[model samples]
Target: MSKFKYIVVALLLSACTSDDTDTLIENSNTLTNYLQDRSVENGAVIACAGNTEDDTVSVEIFFYPEEDATNYRLYETSSTDVDSNDFLNYNRIFLNDAPVFNGYLRKFTGEFTTERWFIVSFEKDNEIKLSNPIRLKNESQPTLFANAISINQQLSQMPLFNWNVNSEMNNAIFFQVLSTINNDLISGTYTYENQFQYYDTSNVILNITNGTPPDLVLGDDYKMTIMDVSVDNWINEIFVSQFTVE
Candidate 1:
């Protein structure tokens, strides 16, 4: 996008999230200055999925970065909105300790709370690329596809996943994550429809950012989870299933 358009979007976002008039103006200026000289693109950060268990939560963040990208960084805040300038004050999260999948997805597990926000960035040739602010929401209800879907993993071919839903989705967006039994993310994407045959680009919204889909290890156990996120960003339902690649 043009630099002017990028700054305009940032200014509007800052205004919506800042309650104080002075803070809004300051945030607007910060965003304007930060994005002015940078190359900005939508979908740099595509999708985020979270799992909360009791008092703890695990979040999977996905991003597309340049092949030469280095010095990957994550910043955190307790506020509702975050901009590039906010990263200066936001606490940096060390990703060296997090599990990485396909060199694009990162997983972080920690105590659960209602007020945490995150943003991701990476440096390529000394220029930093930023991702949109992301936050995870708690699940609202069990998903209809809990035990209603069937997956066929054929050797040398993509897996075929089909499901049956008995209720209305209420216009929710579907997101799927394929992971190892130990919770290592393999591939993740969004689908607007109910059925997603693995690696079928036509049926998916945001295809995996990894250059190529990683092969699922035969005879090894794996997990598949599908979450429905509403327009408000809340997770309305989730389906988690485990299987052994036969």
Candidate 2:
């Protein structure tokens, strides 16, 4: 990543929503070739730029359209039944409802699988960037074991969230998980190493205490809505699940 110069998005437009801070000028002379190309090698998924060797990463970054009604920054888990989670980072990644980056290529290496999710943390209020998710196909992917499976039924408040972390993930800095209750969304970013089963005892608890948006209810049917996220052809995996409360 240090080898390439980032291309900052200098587009200017006008705000339309509460989350929108600056106007987006898409066709304007901001910066082009920000990102391009994608591939998988051994077990490492790579994102490429301008077809260069140095500019590559296992995860990818995306930006919201300059003008969108919904707050892209709001972390809303896409409907579980929809089979994909696109809005997982719109809110958690950016405070202003957009993205800003200047560079020719961003390269990364580390453990990657179908169950992994990655996100980039910038300065506060600066936009956040997430890698398109990937859920490795069991057949194509090596064995991924969950040390502890969590299932909470009956009366209770929000339960603690925990899962296995792949030990092979290399160069990973962070992990991002997004869950939903009906249409309500709850997102949490954690240290990448926490994904392994070794830390299941200290699982994460990302709740509505911070006041992100709509809260949960007594009973609701929810699902993780798994899908593979990618930029151009570079694809990362995300896993969804079916869970309920009673």
Best TM-score goes to which candidate? 1
- For candidate 1, the 10 contiguous residues with the lowest summed lDDT are 3-12
User: Model 2 clash tally?
Assistant: 32
Q: lDDT tens digits, residues 74-160, model 1?
A: 666655554423543355655542545545555445544454556666666555566655555543332223545588777434677
lDDT of 2 at 61: 36
Give, for candidate 2, the lowest lDDT window spanning 10 residues: 29-38
* Candidate with maximal lDDT: 1
- Predictions: Cα RMSD each: 6.9, 15.9
Error of 1 at 128 (Å): 2.7
- Candidate 2 TM-score to native: 0.32
Q: How many angstroms is residue 40 displaced in model 2 relative to the true structure, after the best TM-score fit?
A: 30
TM-score of 1: 0.57
